[model samples]
Target: MFNSLISYLDSIRERDPAPRSRWEILLYPGVWALFFHRIAHWLFGGRLFFLARLVNHMSRWITAIDIHPGATIGRNFFLDHGFTVIGETAHIGDNVTIYQCVTLGGTNPTNGVAGKRHPTLEDNVIIGSGAQIIGPITVGERARVGANAVVTDDVPEGATMIGLKARSTLVPAETWLREFIPYGTPCDEPCEPNSGDRAESLERQIAELRAEVEALKAERRGDQPHKMSGTNC
Candidate 1:
């Protein structure tokens, strides 16, 4: 457990670039949240509900992040810029990447006794900043949820979801990282320009080209009659 904590600290230090000092790095709320999560989760599973709730409340007070003790979180689950909210029945799998302001919430209107009200996030899912994944839907493994996306349905494995209603802008894992990953100083290359807007621009150019070609053809046809009359003389 001590070794795991050390490794987790190392990971946080390595991943975060804006850490001003060693003390700042050590004082990250995310690390503390992870520690509290583990303890709360253990108490929850052990049926020590009162203590688990106390730990959960304390963690939330300190981190401004709320993770229900009933929620199942897997290994190496990093919450970047943590202050995110998770639902009681939410099930998160291993290596899940969750950014700030992401919510795994329930859609059930009653808010009664919690029994699978929240969503299930499968392994290796990357949820972008401020994304809202609500209801009892399952986000499949390796799926990518774009920033500020509002997803209310089940996302397929390896699919990339974007926009308000969360449409699939599917891309392979390698292609996604190369083409859509946002710019960063540590990143090797710039993201490919968005194809959707580029396609619209191309279509507008094509329309203009077609109109120009038609005008040229008409001008040639008009001149041909005059040329024919002069030749007939």
Candidate 2:
């Protein structure tokens, strides 16, 4: 058990550079939140719903991270910071890293059945700060959801998603091959309101359109002389 705890702390250290030692990592709110979640989840599985809820509330109050007792979390799942929410039916696989203010939310079903609504995150998935991954979608292994992204669909393996209503961008080979990307975003990629390549393409198009407009205006001005001469004739 001590070895497992050490392993988990080491995993966090690999992802985050701020922690000086394992003891500093242990002081993190995310670590405490996960610890409380384990106790809560065990009680919940034993059908002690009230006790589970009680523990969940305590964790939330202390860590400012709310993880439903019914949520299933795998080994070495890391919540990097606080103010994150994990829904009741959410399932997180091993080595999933979630940043601050991220939400693994569920969609309400009209059929009155509280079925599987929350998302399932596969192993090595990274969710950036303020990302909202809603519905029963499955985020595939090594998928990255960028900061402030709204993802309502299933993310393909090794895909990098960004922007509102998040669109998947082509992951560069260097970025894709890296073990851990800070904030689920590639520093090499331009962090813009739109996808990096797409935004550059749009700018090129706008420049070409402006040049064409200028050429058309010049041609119209030159034709004004001919029109005036023809009127005199």
Candidate 3:
């Protein structure tokens, strides 16, 4: 368990430029969420459904991230920000990175389907902030789902998915990494306007991510954004 914590912190430090120390990492909601999720997932696997749900709720309260206890997440899976939701049947593989306000959600009605209603993300998959990957999709290894993309289909290995329609472009993941693009693929959104402090920058990123999520939701519904008060990406 301690090794896992170290691995999580190391992964974050390697992939993100945010954390200044392990002490600061301790306060991150993602860290707490992943920690308790391990216990919750164990309880779920042991068939202790009631206890698992209780742990899930507690984790949600503490972390503000809703990861169903039944979801199977592999090593070094980092949920970069809070408000991320992973569905019960979702399976995330090793070294996956998911940013804020993303959802690995169900599309089919529970009453209508008997099996996996969520997505399976393979190793090294990076889901951008505010992306929604719904239904029983298989996102292959090293594939990237862009910010605000609504994916409902299988993604080929090393592909880059863009937009609500999820138009996929097959690019070798190795080549992309060789190019040194941050976050696996080139992002669509512009860089956040330089905020003075780390806290301010974090808050600004969250707001941008949230707005992108809302805009994507609106696009899928074929309507204008409901909240007209703020600038939306």
Error of 3 at 88 (Å): 0.6
Return the clash pairs for model 2, or none. Answer: none
Candidate 1 local distance difference test against the native: 0.79
Model 3's alpha-carbon lDDT is 0.82
Model 3: per-residue Cα lDDT over 1-233, one tens digit each: 78867877888889888889977877888879988998999999999999999999999998899999989999888788899999999999999999999988875442454588788999999999999887777999999999998886789999999987533434444533443332223333233334357678789999999999999987867644544434563
- Reference-based TM-score of each model: 0.66, 0.75, 0.68
lDDT score at residue 165, model 2, on the 0-100 scale: 61
Give the alpha-carbon lDDT of every model.
0.79, 0.89, 0.82
Cα lDDT tens digits, model 1, 43-145, are 9999999999999999999998899888899877778877799887899998788889898877543434546768899998999999988878899999999
Ranking by TM-score: 2, 3, 1
Of the two candidates 1 and 2, the one with more favorable TM-score, higher being better, is: 2
Look at candidate 2 and tell me the lDDT of residue 84: 99
Model 2 alpha-carbon drift over 4 Å, by segment: 166-214, 217-233
Order of candidate numbers by lDDT, starting with the best: 2, 3, 1
How far in Å is the alpha carbon of 233 misplaced in model 1?
21
